[model samples]
Target chain A: MAARKPVFNQQVLYDTTPLPDSIPKVKELGATSAPLFSASFFIGTRCKDYNDDYMQCKTENPGKGEFECLKEGRRVTRCARSVIKDLNTSCLEQFRAHWECLDDNNHQLWQCRPAEWNLNRCAFEKLGLEKVIPDQPPQSTPVHLRKKMIFAHYPIPSHAKPFITGQEEAKPKAS
Target chain B: MPQDMPPVGGYEAVQYKRNIPARGFRAGYYLAGAGAIMAYGWYHLIVGLRERNELAREKMWGRIHLIPALQAEEDRDLVRRHLADQAREKALLGENIKVYHSDRYVRPTFAATPGSTTK
Candidate 1:
């Protein structure tokens, strides 16, 4: 069989789109929580890593059998698996509860709101994520509308504020 | 001749040799069996090695991620500080920075024109 083209040679990096608000935002907790949105992300990223390793191995050892490149490929795969397993182990209880609730509620966000909140709360407290604060008090509105409006008006937390504020503090113009 | 009668001259007894040569047949069977066993063993050896490598990689990566979970409060705090520093440095460098375009706002390029297709 003709040698297959290496995946890395194709400039298609894995999708970097942020997870939709509908799915849980566990990764927002930074490196402490799951590195990516879903367990599948872990698998995909790891697969990419494995492919990279395999390609590198092939380039270095042309005409070698699959067994020759197995060493590096396995290393990458193991690393990815471990990262996923760690995340699961760390937050399995909350993750399970959130998923089960979604399953039970037919994936209706409004119905699973409580479970979602519970999971977020657990992640925030345990994973060192920045807590988002609303700019104004919540208004009396439909649950879905309220959620949308709340996020719309949410301001960055002080701890997580960006270093660059376009308006520099008035320091007398540097002489 | 009556239907049930034996050949008229005599009941001549004839013998036939074995259809297959026993020596060759036995040798072929033995070779085939050995080949099959070797193939099976080779297949399993490859699979076992693959599995072992996977397990090892998993363990290695797991420990890296697990560090945060297993750290003491002070260590965790240090990690958080390190991350904040990294973010600040990146912002300062401003490498490959892209302008943020909010979905709420429509740019001329995005606006639909008469007789034009919307993307």
Candidate 2:
């Protein structure tokens, strides 16, 4: 058979686009869960390799595992499970950190503040996220007038909420 | 013998036409192509089935072999941990030899089995 090029190698090399959001977020935090592995299956079927290009690194110089890198001189390593576990734990830790940060700043509108959004900035040097408190009167209209304005803009029936409530509370028929 | 009977030469020619090998060659080619296609299909089907069987075997052995071998749930949990450890070692560390397997048909003979042996 004539030598055919592989499907993956045919793509353009240097076409730059914005990186994906998930990868950066994952990297920033780190996981904490136990790694669930499908590496052996990959090795048996897809990769057909015992090299460094595999996702995980070997413990010894050359390991016997499917995902282990082939060393220049030594035995091959074989530990797909541990590598997956590490990855999971790291990801979970990262997620937990991000979650905690967000939880701590429950009232903050902006998550990351770099001490820049102000004119009298020297007086307020504490670099923290801004808190957004809702306006009482809103400086736009009174409660009734605002309600009327909203009703004008988006005209749902006044009794629509009550009707939804009734529908939710409605019981099943006997049959 | 005058009008009803055909000439022997014409009858032989009709027989020769009926006995031509072209039909046999076509049938042979058709059967060969069909066989090749069927074999190709069967080869992939077997491979898929084998892969599934291997996965099922791993699951079964994990439950039957590893679980029962351990005493406590903690020990079983340790084995589960070790399975991941083995997986990681296999993947990253290249330590595939987590266990051993023997050939199905091979049987070992002990020396002098209830009878005289020459040693």
Candidate 2 chain B: minimum summed lDDT over ten consecutive residues — where? B103-112
Q: TM-score of each model's B chain?
A: 0.35, 0.36
Model 1 over residues B1-119: C-alpha lDDT tens digits? 64787778978767576676545557778899999999999998885564444434433443443332222222222323333444545778865233345422111122112243222
Give the best candidate by lDDT: 1
lDDT, each prediction: 0.40, 0.29
Q: Estimate each model's TM-score.
A: 0.23, 0.21
DockQ of each: 0.01, 0.00
lDDT of 2: 0.29
Q: Deviation in angstroms for A24 in model 1?
A: 37
Model 2 lDDT tens row, A51-97: 23332333342323212222211111222223223323443343233
| True-structure lDDT of candidate 1 | 0.40
